[model samples]
Structure formats: C-alpha cells, structure tokens
Target: MARVRWWGTGLVVLVLLILGLVLPLVDKALGSGGTALAAGTVIAVGTERAGARPVTFTVPAAGWALDEARSSLTSNAEVTRGEVRVDLNLVIPLGSLDNRRLWDGLGRIVAMGGGRLPGGPSAVTTRHGTAGLTGPLAGHGKIGSATVFTKSDLGATVTASGPPDAYGRLAGEVRAMVLSVEISP
Candidate 1:
C-alpha cells in the first residue's frame, strides 16, 4: 500500500511539473490566436499614440477635450479576447492640450469620446458617442448607443475592430476611453 501511495505521489508531481511548463506555452499560443491579436491590435492604436499632442479617449459622454491629460497603462491581459487596463488623469484646458487654464483641474472639461486633445492651436470638434462595435478584424456597429466619458463622466462602451478603420472606432480604443471635451462656450 505504501509503495502504491509513493507511486501516486510521483505521478502527481510529474503532472504538476508538466502543467507548469506547458501552460505558459498554451497561453501564449492562445494569446497569439486571431481573436486575441485582433483585440490587442485594436486597443493599442488609441493608447499607442497617447503621447501625441492632443491626447484623446472615449467615454460614455461622447466627445470632449481637456486642457491637459496624463495616461498610464495599469494592466493588460490576453485570453480568447484581449483586455487592457490603463489609468489616466486629464485636465481640460481653456482650449486644448496645448493651452491650459491658469489653474489646473479647475474648469477642466471631462470629455467622453476623447481623453486628451491635440496640442495644435486649432478649433477641433470633439465627437460624442455611445456605440456598440462588433465584427471581424474591423467591427461595424451603432456608435450612438455607445456612451463615452469625456462629456459628462458618462460611460461609453466601444465595440469595434482594430486597424483599417482608423477613424471609425479609433482601433478598438473608443470603448476603453470615452470622455467629453470642453468648448469655449
């Protein structure tokens, strides 16, 4: 009986070791799968260019700009679908990212469709939205029903594809960041 028990323990240990070594590969394989790749590609577009002059994000509100903006990547995950978490702090300028109010965080407009606005000194129109995007490499869905944050601290969920459709959904980034912009009004 003791010998049998010893054999069982050995088998369990071997299986555990195999799983530990093999699971990572399996996860990687899945992560590289079409679905995950698509999702990641979609999300990365908006975030990747965050450093640009006007930082834009989408929230439930629709579209709005801030005086200033700051963003950070909190976490990211790969599964059947990809998921990424980014932390952000934005201040609406009296104008756009380049211009700012004399004070910070004061008079900052919380936008929905875009997080940070372009620093370029130009009158930009922020697009507000509440959309549901869905499709293959490129998604096609109703953007109105989707909400963005910049506008009114509202929540917007984006359901779209990545790449190709550059403006359509901002490459799957609309849902993650939906905020409103503040106008001179």
Candidate 2:
C-alpha cells in the first residue's frame, strides 16, 4: 500500500511538471487561445488578380488579433486589440474620383453609418511613396481616423477607432501600422 501511494504521487507530479512546461508554449503558438496575434505580424488583404493591388500591413505592437468572423473577404481585414479596432478594405472606385472626392465619399459613408468625419483630409504617404489622405473620424462615442490610398481604380481604406482612452493609448502604434501599409502593384 505504501509503495502504491508513492508511485501515484510521482505520476501526479510528473504530469503537473509537464503541463507547466507545455502550456506556455502552446499559448504562444496558438496566440493566447487562438485569437491574439503577436507583435510584428504582417497581415495581407485582397485577392491576386491581373490588376488587383493587394494591401499588406504589419501589426505595430502586441495585443492585436484577426477577427475572422468579421473578416470574410480577401479584400478586407479586421483586427482588434482591447477596445480598439482597425479595419482595412480594398475598394474599386465606380468612376474616376480624385483623392479629395474619395475622401469625401468615405466621410459620407461614415455619416450614413451614424459616424462622422469631423476634420479635413490631411495628406499621408505610405512607406513606398503611395500618396493618400487621412481625416479625423468621430461619432458613436468613439474617436479615430480614416485614411485612403489610391492607385488607378484600386483603393485601400483603413479606419482605426476605439474609445477615447484606448484610442489615445494605441494611436501611435496604429499610426505606425497605417504608415507601414503597402499596396503591391
């Protein structure tokens, strides 16, 4: 009886030791329960076509995850970190719309959705010299910015927003991510 008790105790300890060592590794591989993405992860959106320019961007820091259910297309992606959310979409303009018009259209779309773009568009360029415009987004008790980059008929729009505090906290990283966006021709 004494020997059996010792063996059972040893087996239990071994199982616990193994679990302690393996759980962390599993968490890392699965992105902390298979939702969060590690920092510096590059995400690609859009399908490969003859003239389709795909958009790709990197996660600026930790605590971001791909919201798979909300992201249902090759031309769009949604990522979230806490209360902050960033959405990227690839669009084809219906007609020849200049940068300013595109920005206005985007603002109108936001307003239709019960949101508003409160400020004028500001020029922003990507790392690869893609010219774009960004403007302040407000309404629905959240604050953010909307940026649009265009090449020919292809357009990439990025919107990042969250509650005031969370938006402020992640604003820098979010901006970096936006600046890091690249549209492959």
Candidate 3:
C-alpha cells in the first residue's frame, strides 16, 4: 500500500508538472503572442534623419506590446493589445508632397494592401502641435483611423485598427497615442 501511494503521488506530480508547462503555451496561443508592454512606455518609430531628432510616441494605456516579429526600426513599427493594433511608418516623399497628397497616397497604398479608407481626410493637430490629416480606415473586419503628420519633407503615418467593439473600447487610448506623437526639430 505504501509503494502504491508513492507511485500515485509521483504520477500526480508528473501530471501537474506537464500541465504547468503546457498551460502557458496554450494560453499564449489563444492570447496575444507578444510580450506585454507596460503603460506609459515611450516607443521610438522610424529611422533617425541626419542631424534631426527621431520620432517617437507613447503607449497611452496598459495591455499593449511591441510586435517584434512584425516590426522593423528601419521601415515601420507595430504594437498590439488584444485585437487592436497600431502601426507607424515614416515617409520621405520623392518630390514636394502636400498633406492632402500624402494622405491620398497612403489611402491608395492601403487599398493595394486589401484595405480601404472609407472616409475622406480631415485636418487634425497632434498634441505636439504637428499638423496632419486623419480619416476612417477599414479592412479585414476591423475599423479604425489612419493619420498622417507632416513636417517639411518628412511625414509620419499612424494607423490603428481592430474589431468595432474592441476599437471603440480603446479609441481614446489610441487617440492619445496618436496625439502623443512627437517629431522634434
């Protein structure tokens, strides 16, 4: 009876150990796969221009994380929380590109990528006093906004999207993040 008890205890411990190891994997598979980023974390986006400051934005709320696999410093940066995702990209126009032209171009690019800008662009100013254009974005059963902030030859575009409910719940946070963008002189 003592030996049987020992064996049963060992089997239970082994099962528990296996569960402990496998549960997190299952959770990750079902949950967000990236590492979580704390609220208030400032993230630098885009490459630094010569003798110019690099652009950066703050994570306005908790539950966000940098999607490392889908992000690249030289090209673009993507961050996600739950179903919502925010993407930032730096644009350098080959010629003189006005805000409206840039916004239109970005819309075309979005359409090319199987997305659509359902609304026209409207003027918006970031908290840092940068001027930009913003409009509705929809694709892949998600809805959000696409905004472009320009300063001289350099421009930065921020796109945020998710399911309607999730996007609505996090709209303020997303707006805060977009407004928090800073393009230093």
Candidate 4:
C-alpha cells in the first residue's frame, strides 16, 4: 500500500490556492478578446502639438496646456489644467509590429504597472484605427484613462488624469478627447 503524505497534499493545496487567487487577475489581464468601447461620446475640444515630434492631435478640453513634451524611443506630451494632467505618448517601432500586437503589448505593460481600466481592455475606434482602452486606473495624483492605438509603425498611448472631483466634472470632455484624437501628418 502507498503511504499518504500530508505535506505533499498541503503543498498541492497551497499551490492550488495561489492559482485560485491569481487566475482571475490573469484572466482579467488577458481580457475577454471582445472589443467594445464603453457607452459614451468622445468630444473634440481643441488641437495641440502632441510631442517634440511633428505630430499633433485633438485635445478634449479647452484649458489644457503643454507643460512638457518630447520625442525619442517614445514621443511624450504632458498637458495640465489645475491639478489635472494628461499625457500623450507616441512610439514609432523601427521593426515590424501590427496594431493588435502593439495594443496587447502596451496593455500588459499597463497592467503590470497597476494601471487597470475600470472595465478592462475594450475595442474602440480612433482617428487612425481600432485601439484598446483601459482604466479609469489610478494616475499620479488622480484617476485616469489610457488609450492605445497603432498605425503602420507607430503606436500611441494617451493617459488623462486629474483629481477625482475635477475628473468627474470633465469626464465627458475627456471621453470626447479620446474620440477626437487625430494624428497629423
């Protein structure tokens, strides 16, 4: 007869328990593979130079100003109003990478950074192409939204954040900004 080992059983149980706790998170991070933007209308408020690169996009609100903007491996723009801050990031991959892959890659990076969309990743249409949206995740000093899109060799991410009260006030305009994003040639 084979002897039963309690420690072995306990170890197996522990591993299972850990997986049980982690599986949901992993599943959430992987997403449902269904793409649906949350119900809201994206509004376009204005336009500005997005980064040091010659690229530009529509701003969702009127008061935002470029505090600091630059370009390198990634082109980044930071806009601010009161305590609210918005960051626009653009990356032009030197090698071949398509939109879906680029979106997923950025999604994983966002998830690892503890930035989670309230509704997780979803499908949304941008000026350029279909993109992924995440958050309402926590940002530097407020709640924020992250949107990622890719076209040809370029991948872009926009993060908008502000104080909870202020964010609530500007939420619709912000959504419009996401909808109105247009990359300038």
Q: Pick the candidate with the highest TM-score.
A: 3
Model 2 / residue 71 / CA error / Å: 0.6
TM-score of each: 0.29, 0.77, 0.80, 0.56
Candidate 3 per-residue C-alpha lDDT over 72-137 given as tens digits, one digit per residue, 9 for 90 to 100: 876677999888899998787799877788898999999998999996788898888998899899
**Ordering by TM-score:** 3, 2, 4, 1
What lDDT tens digits, residue by residue, belong to model 4 across residues 1-185? 99877998899999998799888788878643322223332212222335334334555545655553222323565655566656667666778766556656766776787665456567777655545554556744578777776655566677777789988787776676666565443
Better candidate by lDDT, 1 or 4 = 4
Give, for candidate 4, the lowest lDDT window spanning 10 residues.
37-46
* Candidate that beats the other on lDDT, 1 or 3, i.e. the better one: 3
- Can you write out model 1's per-residue Cα lDDT over 1-185, one digit (the tens) per residue? 35345888899999998899888888887554332122223222122334432233323322222212221222121112123222223323344422222112211331233332222221223344322222121122212112212322211222222234333534334433432322111
Q: For candidate 4, report its TM-score.
A: 0.56
What do the candidate models score in CA lDDT, each in turn?
0.30, 0.84, 0.86, 0.60
TM-score of 1: 0.29
lDDT of 3 at 58: 90
Q: Considering only N, C-alpha and C atoms within 3 Å, which residue pairs clash in candidate 3? A: none
- Provide the clashing-pair count of each candidate structure: 64, 1, 0, 3
Instruction: Score residue 50 of candidate 3 by CA lDDT.
Output: 81
- What ranking emerges by lDDT with the best candidate at the front? 3, 2, 4, 1
How displaced is residue 63 in candidate 1, in Å? 21
